[model samples]
Target: MPKGKKKTESRGAGLEEYLEGTVFLDLWRDKMFLGQEFLTWLYLTSEKNNHFFELPGGDGVEAFFENRLTLSHGRGNNRRSVAITTTEEPRDPDWDEAYTAIGNNKRVIKGTLRVKAENREWRLTLPHDTLSPQGVKLSAVKDPAETDDLGKAGKFLDKIALTAELVSIVDELFSLFLSRRLSETWLTEDVPRLKEYLSSRT
Candidate 1:
């Protein structure tokens, strides 16, 4: 027998046994909770800290929940979901409906966000499960069609740079969240304060 085939068989020997339980389902559910916890923390920090953040690299950013926010709880057939939306130019941070849902133990799972760095801004919807930006809108770039053929390349590069910058900002923020979330201070200090903040709102 080929060496690779032998190794594959060795690795697969106990696969059937390991696949025969609820372990994988439990692990997946745990991961989903991490996403919910991260978004919940992000919302709490955004409100308490006035939507201002200092990145690990010393740059400042302002990110706020805007227009739409979705929160969810439970799993399978027991799952509950809520969406909060507004037409106000600057959404009221003290929106009662959002606070009521949070007070009821819902966690933010999807949200529309506005993030600003320097003078540039990005608007996007972020889903907790994938943590991927959706419907992204970046600061206006020069219209490629209006530019000379030579300048069109430059405009294209400009768009790419803006996209990259947005990704970098979001990645940094998520990294910051994970680091804090995994720390003991999260349960001891952060969560207690988070509860207090939520209570005051609702």
Candidate 2:
């Protein structure tokens, strides 16, 4: 058999076993579950979140909401607080493959977010006499304007979509690597060719 055909057959068998109940299959499943759990945890932990826009020239703009929740009785009350921040980054030369070292020279809109929740106590008890119920609050901390020409752009980045795109990219890159299509100059040469092939499918 030809060497390439043998290698292909070997890889096919490995992949088949990976899709079966093999140890490698379990490892892959576990990793995927871990990643899903992490993302879900992040969403649940944050009380409030914001999205910002990145301008072309220098700075950016953002808009966010502050949430404050209060639990009150006749005389006693409790307060809880949280915050969310959203920001955008324009597609620029700086964020290209040469700088970010991710993959292609695609411009990414990045969002920076933070959330905090605290419980506050009341002095006197009112009609209801139960253990202190927590109050939830959320706020947006930073909103900086730009000195450059580019104004703020409003575009939401869905985490699920981004994750899917990432997975696709990884799958493609791995297939290329396994096929020995990637070399030291792969980034400079083969990457574009692979992209063209991918584009043709669309």
Candidate 3:
């Protein structure tokens, strides 16, 4: 949130690759899988696929994956590919072709994500590598004049709050995904179904 700041200091490794010699690594591994799997399914379910991720109370969010996709070699690595297509590749002719990228031993790391909730729409790029969102275009403020905090600080505060809310929506979406993704039904039922659907996409 610090805009136009320069980092003039260096620090140690913020995190270990595997969190070796600890019990947290188990959590880390599951988290890594959850993130990647969620991203993958989100892309697969986008744009009139009838895969609306249900919100907590009611209704659902319409998810759309943008044309630009970043694929990586597995989970942790510097290697990544950014494919910029002209059309809505996930929902159009190139949809089936997009899966071919993942089949080639690469995983979808992140992409331009479009999520619509109520009358507001959020567009941002979410990185699975660190769970950090970038280039966020958050929803419009419902009422900016009613703020107790004033001026730039107020605006920033509102932005941060809205951003956290948006991220919470994403977290809810991930939970919805995990319900099916972590189930034994996923392997026995959903996997075959998804494969059949993908095979039919062309």
Candidate 4:
């Protein structure tokens, strides 16, 4: 057998064996609601303060729900989900329907967010169950094809830096949410304000 093919098969077999263990999957299932709460908190918080967030590390970013939003209620056989989408650019999408759905006890299940940090922007689809960023569109950078080899490497590094920055931003933001969510004031302060925001919207 070819060396490369043998290595690939070994890696695949290892991965399959690893996935056969259910410990992490069980933990994820148990704690999946945290992701849902984070997304819900993001929407509530963004509705105030013009969708801008100041990270715990003192970095400022603006994030807005755009393009699509999904909300859900119940689980298992009783689960129901709805998605809201917009195609227009520049003009903000109206979220009255989503607000109403929330008022009816639905939680945010997924959303497309446009986030701006410094002068650059990124768009991603975030799902509540996993908190993974999907369909990510990063800000435009220098094209490698238009540059010399050295310049191409520099541009490639620039892209890598942007990706790392985005991951940091997401981690920090989620950490902030977890802090607030797990705090003593969440029920007394945040929940009341969140309720008020929904009440006003509906």
Best candidate according to TM-score = 4
My TM-score estimates for the predictions, one after another, are 0.79, 0.18, 0.71, 0.80
Tens digits of per-residue lDDT for model 2, 23-101:
8755654544232222222222121122232222222223211221112112114322122222333322121221121
Model 3 spans with C-alpha error above 4 angstroms: 1-31, 74-82, 87-96, 141-150
Q: What is the C-alpha lDDT of each candidate?
A: 0.81, 0.27, 0.66, 0.78
Residues 70-173, model 3: lDDT tens digits: 76664347665656454644546345556776565556678888777666677899877555678999876476556544679877987886677677677667
**Residue pairs in collision within model 4:** none
Please give the distance, in angstroms, between residue 29's alpha carbon in candidate 1 and its true position after superposition.
5.4
**TM-score of model 2 vs. true structure:** 0.18
Where model 2 places Cα greater than 4 Å from the true spot, the runs are: 1-157, 181-202
| Backbone clash tally (model 4) | 0
Tell me how far candidate 3 lies from the true structure as C-alpha RMSD in angstroms: 8.5
Ranking by lDDT: 1, 4, 3, 2
Best by the lDDT measure: 1
* Sort by TM-score, top down from the best: 4, 1, 3, 2
RMSD of each: 9.1, 22.6, 8.5, 8.6
Q: Please give the lDDT score at residue 20 for candidate 3.
A: 59
